[model samples]
Target: MKKNSINRVIGFVIVGLVLLAAVIETGRSVYTWSQQAAKQPRYTIVIDPGHGGNDPGKIGINDVPEKDVNLAISLELKEILEQNDCRVVMTRQKDEALYQAGDTNKKVADLRARCQMINDSGADAVISIHQNSFTAESSRGAQVFYRASSQEGKKLADILQTQLVSGLDPDNRRVAKANSDYFMLKNTTATMVIVECGFLSNSKEAELLTQASYQRRVAWAVALGVLQYVSGGLS
Candidate 1:
């Protein structure tokens, strides 16, 4: 062959080898991913949408109830989790309190019932969805809370806080906090995090929270956080 022809043939051989290597590497990566996916533990999570029925939790400036927002976000998160092969148990699927309609101590009874459900769920984790309200209408952003004593809860809370701020609210300054006051976090046997999605007191935030698209984003962030935790990303 002529020198130019030989050079072209050599170049083609090199390109072919490079392409073959790339294909092999891609196949190996795919195999590794499949193995990891197959070995991944199927985690069960309890999703508690706070306050229902007569208990609206917080009333937003836009006249949207916190219970509705909470439920909406929780339902979206459940769908996302289930799509990822995780089992989800919702504490309440509708706008009704866990306690009887005529119970005098309905609030307490409802909380206790939710705690019972969480404890009995045999879940890998619990995420209680809620919206915050404050005296100041300017207050905004999402916050995450976990039991102070549970390291796992703290890790999950940290992941959720990071994801929410980065994915949904870029200006969100709220960080993960430790709390012993929440019944869901304090009483649940499984590692739990309470995601205070946004402030209903803030007009801007309240409007966004009431939107289906924003609610879905919030749910997506929460679901991503849980998936990260389960995939050992925290470790």
Candidate 2:
């Protein structure tokens, strides 16, 4: 009897998520539909899905790997961006790491490779996706970070933050933050932002992050943000 009740409650949550996710996709469509082809954004974006292979990143509710969730959302974002006629580049498309064979320090090697790819690609911008986790389980919601000194990075981060808050979680009071100590931000020359998609440490948020529909919603929110940045639409 208890199991049945739990299942029913889960079903209701899923239904509600699907509806909100649909709104996410719709917002992207409406914006693109309203733009003229001559003015459509023609830019290349490098999407880095943080962690993979040996590095599972943060373990969340149900033991879901943050690496897998990151890749899923990134792939969705790539597709959405491409559908809007933007060129997309991915650091790693499969379940693998960017480190070379027999690399002594896998983490450093992987990051270097990702940075090289972004710098060499001449991409208009770069976005590294990762799941967040905090000791405090109550800390949730997505957050954006950019290099403190880069105006371009700040612009992208703020625009993306707005999209994330308004489109996915209006309750997320977090704003775009600037950091100067991050390796990825310092190494990559292009405009870039790191998006912590949500707090995996929060049980309720972890469950939501694991859902394919919710992942797509997060991707849509990001896609809309990227499009807006590339098109010079600040709002």
Per-residue lDDT of model 1, residues 143-228, tens digit only: 99999899999999999999999998788899999998876677777999989999999999999999999999999999999999
Per-residue lDDT over 1-235 for candidate 2, one digit per residue giving the tens place of the 0 to 100 score: 6999999999999999999999999998887877666566589999999999899999996689999999999999999998996889999999888898999999999999999999999899899999999899899999999999999999999999999999888999999999999899988889999999998999988999999999999999999999999889765
Give the clashing pairs for model 2: none
Error of 2 at 19 (Å): 62
Please report the candidate that would top TM-score against the real structure. 2
Q: Rate the local accuracy (lDDT) of all candidates.
A: 0.92, 0.93
Measured with C-alpha atoms, the lDDT of residue 130 in candidate 2 is 95
- What total of clashing residue pairs does each candidate reach? 0, 0
lDDT of 2: 0.93
Residue 164 error for model 1, in Å?
Answer: 0.3
Off by over 4 Å in 2: 1-41
